[model samples]
Target: MDSQSAQLPIKIARIGSTVMNDFLKIPVRTEETSATALPRGAAITISGSWKGSITISSSDELSRRIAAAMFRKDDNSVEARDIADALSELTNIIAGNIKAILPGPSQLSLPMTLETVPEAAQGAVRVQLQDDQAGQLLICVQPGLH
Candidate 1:
């Protein structure tokens, strides 16, 4: 692993906390999880000297909660667009933060939601977190193929 790669987990945790706590206004407790089995969710790729991608996954219930929080809508009234926008924005924000600390000169792709985790995500560093009100959140950082 590259030196920067070793710092991934720490970067992820710090950025995740900042994004959730400050931007999302939600506090979370995160733990390492199996990198292989991320739940269905959205991802955004970053390409540069250090190429990799960031993915955000959560349960449907939790997604709805996030959507509500993001859009300032009631959970019961959250729309699909709200869910998609929230997840995409969350991934984008986290990826942007990570890019800053990583060996840079990188560019981020638009976020995309996937029904199944991508093959590129294999061997990714994964972290899982839960919020009392938002349910569960999974974050994965995968290095790109050289």
Candidate 2:
């Protein structure tokens, strides 16, 4: 059995909580996990789903709020870089968390730039926080020879 397949749930909870509090300025309540196909917008597309992704974006403008929270000195000016950095951090943290749970010999590939605009699509399981904004995390598995 693949190591990642076994520990996916635990990793999601850890990463989801950290990002929600640190970046989203909210608490993570709900959690979900599943296997699925990679969306066309994704940068890395392997045969089947060779990669996994965890998205932690909030439509409530909380991301803007997070920018403010991160840089205490800059409340009036939150640059696009700040938001992008936060997003990148989110991806890293989620990936790391998942990596921690995976069995030895399995490695997590680095995150690549996702050029497409991210839409608010439902994940395998969408977790809605108390702030009314929901966070979706998806983990995709690569094709394995049966």
Candidate 3:
């Protein structure tokens, strides 16, 4: 790894907590075990002087809660598109913060909603988090152009 790629510095738990707390008003705690690939999720990629990607996967309940929070409605009342939009926005916010501090000129791609996370690429870092109301959410960060 070169010095530039070393900027792949990440604080997954802190980032997750702040983003989730601020965006959804839901606090999260980190767990020792990594979170599994969830049925509902989102992923984004960034490339340039410093390159990497972040993938977020969550429990169905959490998905609903997130959508509910965004739409100001009950979890069951939220539509699938609402849930997808919420996840996409959350992923973008988290990735944008990361891209900002990195050795640019970095281009952060649009967030992509996923039915399930694909296999982890080589050199990926996965962090698991648990929320009191929503259960577990996973953050997988890949820290290099590769």
Evaluation by lDDT, superior candidate among 1 and 2: 1
Order the candidates by TM-score, highest first. 1, 3, 2
Worst 10 residues of 1 by lDDT: 31-40
lDDT (Cα, 0-100) at 109 in candidate 3: 86
lDDT of 1 by residue, 3-51 (tens): 7677778778888878888887878877654544445578888888878
Candidate achieving higher TM-score, 2 or 3: 3
lDDT string for model 3 (4-58, tens) is: 4453433656788788888788788887874567778898988888787888888
Runs in model 1 deviating more than 4 A are: 1-5, 32-38, 119-122
Estimate every model's Cα lDDT from 0 to 1: 0.78, 0.46, 0.79
The TM-score of candidate 1 is 0.85
lDDT digits (tens) for residues 1-146 of candidate 2: 46654454455665666766775565555433333322321222222223334444443255555556666536458776665565555556555664454434444544554545344344232333333444333333222322
- Give per-model TM-scores: 0.85, 0.53, 0.85
